[model samples]
Target: MDPRESLIPPETLPDLLAPGLRLISVGLNPSPASVAAQVYFAHPRNRFWPMLNASGLIDETLSPSPDSMRRLFEAHRIGFTDLVKRSTPGVAQLRAADYRAGASALRMRLHGLAPRAIWFQGRTPWSQYLRYTSGEAPAAVWGLQSQTLDGVPVWVTPNPSPANAAFPLDVLTAQLASLANWLARRP
Candidate 1:
């Protein structure tokens, strides 16, 4: 077994969040690998770190680790969380109840943090969040959405999970770049 697995807690991955965050990236849920490593998007093929570095959002390249993520939160004011906290081998293990609870929890966190904008890693988390909170999941596009989470702007990007092969790294990078450009214009 990997040494990182010894660090895993029963609650799985912990949220990397803080007040006054400029942006928050929300994933669908934590994978077992991420939980073991105690890092979001820890999987080698996930493309999250690579896409983030290539998007020009941050000046430095970040490897998948707790320290790198902490630097992102502290230095860049970019936080990380998930629609669901549970770590599972696959999305098929998740249930509607999970989304419901997670959405409520996420709403509370966002309200408390009041980040300038939210960067959803995929449409599922955004749509599920909307569905659970509003009783309807509106059709969404790939970039910025017209909707806001209680006045916090929302931006959606392709899921960086390697399982989501429909989108390549370049596509994900471009989408993140768009979000970066939008953030640059924010007050």
Candidate 2:
């Protein structure tokens, strides 16, 4: 897939979903596999699932099936989104322009969702978002948090892309377990 092509694969790039979506989880962008798989974080090497398990966010280990993820979202009030709606195949396919555009647009989404907490799975997206704002809005940790951001909270976990070297399964699971532990405590 040509990253620069204006024609994005109609292969299921979800639009700006309902702002009613509560726990909005934001990704940096889309990969071809994710687009093709029609599931966010579907890549085999990605650590997203294990992280969720380690974090204790979910009660059971889920198969990387689209249905399971969707079920979890609906039941848990979690939502999925990307900083960029367009597919770029890989990070190298993205330009600085995409980050800037995504950042500007993402802020509007935050206000719209009014989510109790906003979660990002990567440093690029979170660090870039921080560029446009200031002063520790919430407990922005590498894992889950118990704080709020301007009333709404924000948490970040490791990006599960096979490309993100920082979060191998162990690290990723520990991080996700943090989220699970938090979820366990919530009313």
Compare the candidates by TM-score and give the number of the best one: 1
Alpha-carbon TM-score of each model against the true structure: 0.93, 0.78
TM-score between model 1 and native: 0.93
Give me the displacement of residue 133 in model 1, in angstroms: 0.5
Q: Candidate 1 residues 115-169, lDDT tens each?
A: 8889999999999999999998998789889999878889999999988999989
Candidate 1: 10-residue stretch with minimal lDDT = 6-15
- Please provide, for model 2 over 1-187, each residue's C-alpha lDDT reduced to its tens digit, 9 standing for 90 to 100: 6666745546544733455555678898877777777777778887787677656666677766778667767776678888876787687787767777877777666665676567788767777666544423333558654544456666777888888885688887776666656655665
Local lDDT at 36 for model 1: 78
Question: Which stretches in model 2 have alpha-carbon errors above 4 Å?
Answer: 1-12, 15-22, 132-141, 144-150
Please give the lDDT score for candidate 2.
0.69
Candidate 1, residue 104: how far the Cα is off, in Å = 1.0
